[model samples]
Target chain A: MTVEAREARQPWILLTPAVSAVLLLLFVPLAFIAVYSFWLRTATGADQVGFYLDNWREALGDAFYRDILLNTLKIAAITTVFCALMGYPAAYFIARSRGNKAILLLLLMLPFWISYIIRTMSWINILGVSGAVNSALMALGVITEPIQMLYNEATVILGLIHFLLPFMVLNVYVSLEGIDETLEDAACSLGATRWQTFLEVTLPLSLPGLAAGGLLCFVLAAGTYITPLVLGGPTDAMFANLVFEAIITQLNWPLGSALSLMLLAVLGALVLLYNRYLGMAQLMKGLG
Target chain B: MGWNLVRVWTLLVYVFMFAPVAVVLLLSFNASQFGSFPMTGFSFRWFVELAENEAILRAFRTSIVLGLLTALISTTLGVLASLALVRYRVPGANMISTILIAPILVPEVVLAVGLLLFLNFLGIPKSFPLLLAGHVIFTLPFVVLVVQARLVGIRRDVEEAALSLGASPVQTFFEITLPLLMPAVLAGGLFAFTISFDDITGTLFWKPGGVETVPTQIFAMLRNSISPEINALGTVMIVMTVGLPLLGAAIARRMAAGRGA
Candidate 1:
């Protein structure tokens, strides 16, 4: 082969294994789901092959599914907001700190390294009826009885915020760290108040990080299954829980695939919108 | 005074972050079977019980084996892909990069359902091999991202100079480029291993019948019952998770400083 041809071929050769793996494992499965979403599930729970729109119609037309989707979005939105409120200040503090930044960053990352399940379980111990919080409250005479804290929508949101706060903080911290310290000093030197300078300079500079972090938090919170399942009551089950029950418990793959696709579609729409505005390349760079 | 407020707020945030972890640590040593408050005196009984629990031990073994396999395979593929992307002006490089990282953007539940459907369609039973494949797909992007970042930071002139010195491309890669990229490769491999080991959402869907990884097993156990042994297990995992990365960072810093000196 010619040198140019060989050089061109070398990249494809090197990329073959990784690219093929992604194709076969990731894309092919997603295609299968798309196809399956249009197929019918028999009364006996077996998949009936061939194109049908009943799954889509059922998922979309039913008020129950609609409410669940809305509820999922609501929970995700609340979680994202809380993450922003909590994480922005923390990230700012970390970025501005003159102390050991590496250690502080490591502390921020410590919770993430542990299993997510374990972290959620810790909440159970803290919030259960006879758990730590209740015992403390009772001991301090703050309440007459243990308030039921576990297995609720509030707890679900709390758990999500807990899980996602690190991502938000890390993203914001990266952007905040990138900002020139001189800009903040200049704003102050120009007689801007602390709040004004923060609002005008620091906040605007870190908006990209805030947007990226919020987007990630929203996507993750909306799609998470384990947190809701472990921490939520019967009324708090999200769309993911519905998909899980349909496929695993009911053995109804067609309906499950339909629900999965719908969830993916909504999330995929948000991602496309995000890409349109901020660019996926830039988002990934911030994340990395 | 304002700075003090910020410091207090940051301290509170740190406390919030560590609160649950502290609870897990404290509960692990409690003598009570139920992980409720009011310490019943510190004891290692739960740790002993955890050691004796066959189901959890077996699941832990499965997770460790799976993590090692995932690290090995994903790291190998990631290093090669990183080299290609970093060194060569590959056609469709942007598209390839996006495709590789797309898995991270997709929700784990969504990916799990898709994988389950695909496997069912193919009449393939869920097993270790299938789980391994799923993990590699989930983790390869991270490996690529890490190794690619390191590769980009490295000066290309070193490799070019080696090539100009009459060394073959293969020799230059091994003798020059590989050494520079080793730390990133190792870090990426460890990251992949940790992710695979801690994964439960995807594993829940694809794990073989009658088999469980540690996280899956923990999830099941927590759902059915609360026990001190689970807390003990959590503590062990926390130690490893926190300890390993800190240790790795320290070693890397030492090596870097030594080379500088």
Candidate 2:
């Protein structure tokens, strides 16, 4: 075969396995879930062959599901704000530093590689009744009791923030790293105060990164299961946790699938917003 | 502007970030049976205790095997797919790329349920290979994206020169292209391995009876409370995960600077 022919064939040959896997595992299954969401769970444990909007109707209309949705958004928004607040200064410091930036960046990113479950559990060891935080407080006589720490909304948020902060820092860092240092210098030379220049130039340009990071933090926090499962109170459940309960404990696959589809719908809408406003390149860059 | 102010702020951030993980690590080494604070005398008992825990050991073996297999398969597929996307102007390239990356964007719970339903419908047994397949699907996009970034930096003329010199395509790729892509391939492999190693949702859904990975095992144990053995494991993982990647990123950064200079 000619070289061009061989080269042309190679790409398809290499792409076959991945294309098939993704189609089968990711796309096909999601399509099935979309279909399942329309079906009804029967008196027995199986999904019934009926087309209805009950799942969607319940998800939108029921107060329980509505509360879960609102809680998901609340936790995600809080996590995003905290992450950005903490992450920006850290990313800025690392970006501005000379020799220490790489080290600082590494430290921020290290927790990402460890298991999310482990990291969430680490908080348990630190914040549980007999855990470290209360121990320290008691040692210092700061509180009379081992304050309730784990299995609370505060602890759930703490775990989500801990897990997500690296992502926020890294996204902002990537954007900051890409900005030309000369622009900041030029702003300074043009009689702009450091704060004024930052407000006018740096913040707007970095807004894409901020939005991307916030979206990511929100998606992850909203969709998370292990954190809430491990550290959250019974009432602190997110929508994803409800999906888990429906599947595993309740044995209601159709309802679980319906709830998951609702989560996906909201997630898809938000992702669309990010892609439109923030740009896909920026979103992907932030993810990396 | 004050140096001390900067120092205090940075110190607080560092402490906030590292303190919990650090506490877990410290408590793991304590001689006390309970995984708690107020240091008892140091001992290696948990490490030994971890070794003796058959469930933990079984899960560890499963995780390592899964991670290694997933890394190799995903990295190979990723390298090839990345080469395709980068070198060829195929139709539907954008769509192909988007679909490939869609897994990363999809919620894990959704994917897990979808995969379970699909596998059940297909009558495929949820076995080790099935779990491996799940992991590969999850990790492949990451490998492709990272490897593609590195591949874009490679000059095509180098490959063209080899082709013009009567080198076979395979020869050119092996001698020139593959070697140049090594850093990225390794990086992608590391990424895949880490994701596979840490995965819980997909594994939990797909894993067969009597086969549990580390995260799944820890998750079951965590229903009671966080164990000291997990803390020791986490400490070891923290060192390797952070240490190795940082070393690689630093090396890459230095190389880029050196070239620029």
Candidate 3:
């Protein structure tokens, strides 16, 4: 081949392995699920080879699945709010600091280096009925009975916040870090109070991070299975947990795929909405 | 200034971040069988017990292999993808990058189950290579992102200069580009390794029975109560994940400083 043709062909050649893998493994499998969502499963846990919309029909019509969807969205929304509320101040503090910013950022990321399952289970030892918190509370005469704090929405939220808070903090920190400190200083010199300057200058710029972090938290919370498996009770199962139950326990692949699609659709909608409002570039900046 | 509010908030936030890990590490040393309640005297008994556990040891070995292999595969693909994106003006480059990275966006559970079903339909048994392929799918984005950041500064003139001196394309890549790109390549590989090693959701769904990675073993162990062996495992993993990366970052930073100076 000529040099120009060789150069032209090189990019495609280099990309062949990765592109094929995505097409085969990620994209095609997801497409398989999309097709399987409309098919029926057999008694032997295999999908029948005919197209039908029964799975989607049942998923859309069933109050049980509807409740799971709503509960998943609700839990995700609540978790996002809690993470943002807790993460914003910490991120702001780190961003506002002059030196040791890298150190603080590293500290925030330390927890994420460990296993997700281990971190979720750690709450059991700390929050169980006979665990440290209840035992300490009982000793202090906070209540006669140890509070039922282990398996509920409260515990689930706490676990999610613990897991997701670092992401939020990191994203918000990136956004705040990108803001020109001189602008805030200028606002202050123009007679704006510290609060006023923060309100008018800093927070608006940090909105991109807030939106990105909030989206990350929402997606994670909505799809979390393990945390809820370990920390939540029967009543608090999210849609992912339902998907897990349907596939692993009930052997309902068709229903499971349908639920998976629903979760994916919901998350995709939120992401699109976020991009429309906050700009995809800002969210993309926080990901690496 | 009333920024003491911010100061106290910072302290509380740090406490919240460290508390779970500190508690786990403490309990890992507890002498009592019940993970709950009063601690008996601290001992190294659990750490010792972890050494005798064959399953955990095997899982650790498997994990190291998996991590290394996944890192290799993903970094190769990622470096190639990065080169394609940076060096060539291709149609749909942005769209292609987005699609390649979309694996990170999709929930791990969805990817896992879908892959499981897809493999089953294809009649491919879950094996080591399959597991590696799955891990590569999840981690390729990290490698690309890390390398892409570093690739931008590498001027096109350097390659052209090498070529003008009669070097072949491959020679130009190795003798010129690869050496310069080494730091970023290593960083990307490290990210891929760490991600594959710590993977839980995708690993759990797609793993063949009787073949347990560290996380899967830990999952099984947690069904009872948190054991000292598991604690030892977590502690070791934490050290590897954070300590090694920091060490590498320090070395890279030193190299950069020396070059600049």
Candidate 4:
């Protein structure tokens, strides 16, 4: 082989192992799930391998599944909104601060680095009937009884927000840091008030990061099984919980595969839409 | 006044972020069995209990071994892939990079279920090896992203200089490129370790019968009953999760400073 041909061939040789591994493990499994979704599961917990549309019809036609799917999206949307609302200001503060940025970022990241399960479990210590919030409230005469704070839709959203807020903050902070100082200065010089300057200059400029963070948080919140399992009530179970049940508890792989594909399809559509408008590559780069 | 308000808001945000962690830390020391507040006096009873618990100990052992294995496997693959991506002109490079990192974007539940179904279909027993494969899939993207970032920052001239100085491509890579990439590789490995160690969603689905990682054990414990032992486990996990990255960062910073000096 010529030197040029050899040089051209080297990348393929180097990439083969990792690429093949990913193809076999990730892509092949996904393809399997897609195919499995079309198969049948008997009442006896055995998979009947034949092409059938019953799983899709059952998953999509039933109100129970529809409601669960909608609830999952709603919870994810609410969690994303909360993360953005809470994260943007903190990110902005850290970005604008003249010093101690590292410490501030570390503080934001500390909880995030901890296990998601542990972080969700911590809420039990804080939000349980005899937990900290109730104890504090009772002491202050805010409420006479310990209100049920854990095991609710709101608590599930809170858990997700806590888990996803750091990503939002980090992404927003990256974009915020990328903003030229002079643009804000220019807006100020043009007689815009601080709020006006922020509304026009800063918010719009940092929107890419916000959008990226929001997408990520939504995807995470929508797909999370542990948060709902631990923090949510029976009624608050998201679509993922159903998937877990069908696969693990019920041993109905066909139905579970169907639900999994449905969830993936919805999330995939949202991501594709996002990519069409704002390229995923650019958004992810901004995230970093 | 506005600046002060913003500062206070940021402080409140930090408090909100750390409140649960603080509560967990405090509860770990509490002598109370119910994990309720109101000062039941500090004690190390939970830590002792945790140390004595065989189940938790076994799970901890599993998590550490799995994490180490994942770090080793993913980082090696990630370094090679990143080298191809950054150094060589490859067709479909963008597409390849996207595929590699796609796992991070996909829902963990979807990945877990898919893997479970795939493994089951193939009659691959749900074993540690399978779980390790699943974890490597989940974590390889992080390693690639980290190492790729570092590789991008490195100038091509350095490698070119080594090549011109009678170093073969492989020798140049091992001597010149690998040394430069070490910090990134180490960071990526640490990230992979932490991710694999904390993985509950994937581990829950893929772990074989009777096998448990720390997070899975903790999840089961929490579901069954709340205990100070769980608190102790949480405390240890928090320390590891927080300490490992900080330690890695410190080492990387020191290494960078030494190179500068």
Candidate 5:
């Protein structure tokens, strides 16, 4: 082969493995999921293979599934808000601090490496009936009986925040770090108060990061079943939980496929919107 | 907010983040059989119990093996792919990279169900290798992102200089670019291992009947007994996952610093 031809062929050779893995594994599986969603689960616990729209109709039209999905979105939205409210000040502190950025960022990212199940279970020790808060409070004569803090929607949201706040903080910190400190100073020097300068300058500038973080937190929380399973009550099962039950417990692959695709569609739309506006690079940065 | 107030808030947030897991580290040694507080006493009974538990040990071994395979496969594929995408002219590079990254954006449960369906369609039953395949797909995006970031930061002149010194293209790449990319690859490899080790959502589905990783083991323990030994197991796995990345991060930093110096 000629040198130019060899050079041109080089990239494709290098690219083949990863691209094929994604195509053969990820994309092909997704096509399978789309196809499976059209099938039916028979009474004998076997998938009835056919071009059927029954699962999609039941998934989309059933009020039970619809309520759970909306509830999932509601929980995710609330978690994103809590993460934003709790994470912004912390991100601001870390981003603006001197000489400790690496340490703070490492600390921020540590929980992400830990097991999600462990992190969700941590709240059990914290807020369980005989948990730390109750034990401490009872010891101090604050109350007699232990409070039932676990297995509820509130704890579910709390666990979601615990899992997601670092993402929020990291995104905002990256954004805040990119804004020149001089810009904030200039606003203050122009007779703006500290509050006014931040409100008018720093806050608006970091909105993109906050939005990116919010999108991420919402998508992740919506798709999670573990938090609800570990920390939520019987009625607090989210959309992912429904999908899990359908596949694992109910032995209904067709319905599970439909429910999962419905979720993918909603989250995929958000991801596409994010990619179009802010791009996936920011998401990568936050993940890193 | 005032600087002091912000600092206080930040301190509180750190407490909030660490307290949950840190409490486990402490409670793992508690003399009591259960409960989180009142400090009955400090003992290693739970750890001792965990040490003797064969199932937990087996699960941990399974996890290490799985993590190693995941790291090896994903890192190799990621390095080659990123080299092409970052250093070479590839058509539709943006779209291609997006597809590589789509696995992360797609929810884990969706991936789990989709892959299960795909495998069932292919008449492939869930097993260790299939589980590993799912993990590679899940962890591939991390390796790609990490290596691609480092690759973009690398200057092209070094390879050119090597080429100018009469080295073959492949030889120059092996000698120059690959070595420069090693730190990120090492970090990315560990990240892949840690993520694979820590994953439960997808693993729960992709796991064959009766096969268990540490996360799946913990999920079962949670559903069944809520053993205090779980805290010990949790502590060990937490250290394994968090320590790997921290070590990798430190290595990457030192390598970068060494290069700059």
Candidate 6:
């Protein structure tokens, strides 16, 4: 082959293994899930191989699943809001810091490396009846008895916020960093107060990052069963929990497949919509 | 005054971020078995207990082996993919990058169930290899991102310089290109290791019965009952996972500084 042809072939040869692996592993398995959703689980727990809409009907039509799905979305939405509320000030602080920006950014990223399960479960040690807050409150004589703080919807949201806040902060921080410092000064010189300048200038410019972070936090929080399992009360079962129970506990892979695909469609649609407008580059920047 | 308020808010946020970690660390040294605290005094009994636990030890070994394997495979494939992405205009470039990283986009539970179903459909047993494949798919993107970022910053002139001096394409890759990308390659491998070591959501599904990584083992132990042993284990895990990336970042920083970037 000519050198140009050899050059042309190199990228394909280099890319093929990774590309095919993704195709075989990620996309092909998604196809498998799509196929599995149409099958039915026999009374004996054996998956009956046939195109049946029964699982989809039950997954979509069941009031119990519907309620849990809505609850999950609500919980995820709450977490995203909290993350943004908490993340913005912190991201702004880090982004605007002088001499310690790298350290602050590194600190922000520190929690991201920790195990998601570990991070979620860590809330138990802090909010459990015998945990720090209870112990400290009891010491202070604020209450004679420890308040029940663990295993509640509130705690579940807290766990998710703890887990997802960094994503929000990082994305906002990246966005904030990209904004020229002069713009804030220009706003101030043009007779805008710091807060006014921030509201009119910085916040609007940073809105894209906020939206990106919100999308991410919502999708991740919505998909998580771990935070709920580790921290949520018995009644706090989320949509992903239903999917997990169907597959792992109930041994009904068909129904589980349908449930997961339902989730996939919802999340996948949101991701597509986000991509259409904002692009996944911001997500990548946040993730990396 | 406003900036000071923001700084205080950031400080509190940092405290919030570290509170659980602090609790885990503090309780790991608690002499009490119940993990409740006040004045039980500092003790290393949890650490001692963890040191002697066979199941935990086995799970730790399993995690290490799995992480190493994941790091190895993810780094190799990710580097090649990164090179193709950065150096050449690969066909369907946008789609290919998306596909490569799409594993990260999908929910872990979804990916777990899909992989489990896919393997079952093919008559494949849920085993270590299954777990490894799930992990590699999840982590390969980090390697791709890290390596590709570094690769983008590297000038092509050096590689071209090597090529013009009678060095084969392979030689230029191995000698000129690979060395420049080594830091990122190593950092990406560390990321893969850390991610695989800490993964639980997917591992819980892909694992065969009786097999456990540390995270899975911890999950089992927690589900069975919370013990002080878990505090010790959690502390250890926090240190390892946190330390690995910190080390990776530090190395990258040192190298970048060395290169006068």
C-alpha lDDT score of every prediction, in listed order: 0.88, 0.83, 0.84, 0.89, 0.89, 0.89
Question: Where does model 2 exceed 4 Å of error?
Answer: A1-7, A43-46, B2-8, B243-261
Clashes of 2: 0
Q: How accurate is candidate 2 locally (lDDT)?
A: 0.83
Residue B17, model 6: lDDT of 97
TM-score of chain A, model number 2:
0.94
* Range of the 10 consecutive residues with the lowest summed lDDT in candidate 5 chain A: A279-288
In model 4, how large is the Cα lDDT of residue B203?
A: 90
Rank by DockQ (best first): 5, 6, 4, 1, 3, 2
lDDT of 3 at B256: 73
Pairwise DockQ winner, candidates 2 and 4: 4
Segments of candidate 1 deviating more than 4 angstroms: A44-46, B254-261
> Against the true two-chain complex, what DockQ does each candidate achieve?
0.78, 0.62, 0.67, 0.79, 0.82, 0.79
How many steric overlaps are in each model, in order?
A: 0, 0, 0, 0, 0, 0
Residues B1-261 of candidate 3 have per-residue lDDT tens digits of: 647788788889889878777777887787877665667878778878888889988998999999999999899999998999989998999888877888877887888778877877788766776788799999988888888888998889989999999999999999999988888888989889888888877787777778899888888998776665666667767778878788888888887788679
TM-scores for candidates 1 onward, in order: 0.97, 0.93, 0.95, 0.97, 0.97, 0.97
Q: Tell me how much of the true interface, by contacts, candidate 5 captures.
A: 0.85
Candidate 2 C-alpha error for residue A261, in Å: 0.8
Clashing pairs in 4: none
Task: Give per-residue lDDT, candidate 2, residue A146.
Answer: 96
Cα lDDT of model 2 by residue, A186-288, tens digit: 9999999888888888888887788888888999888888888888988888888888888767767778888988899899899988777756788777665
* Deviation in Å, model 2, residue B46 alpha carbon: 0.6
TM-score of 6: 0.97
Model 1 interface DockQ: 0.78
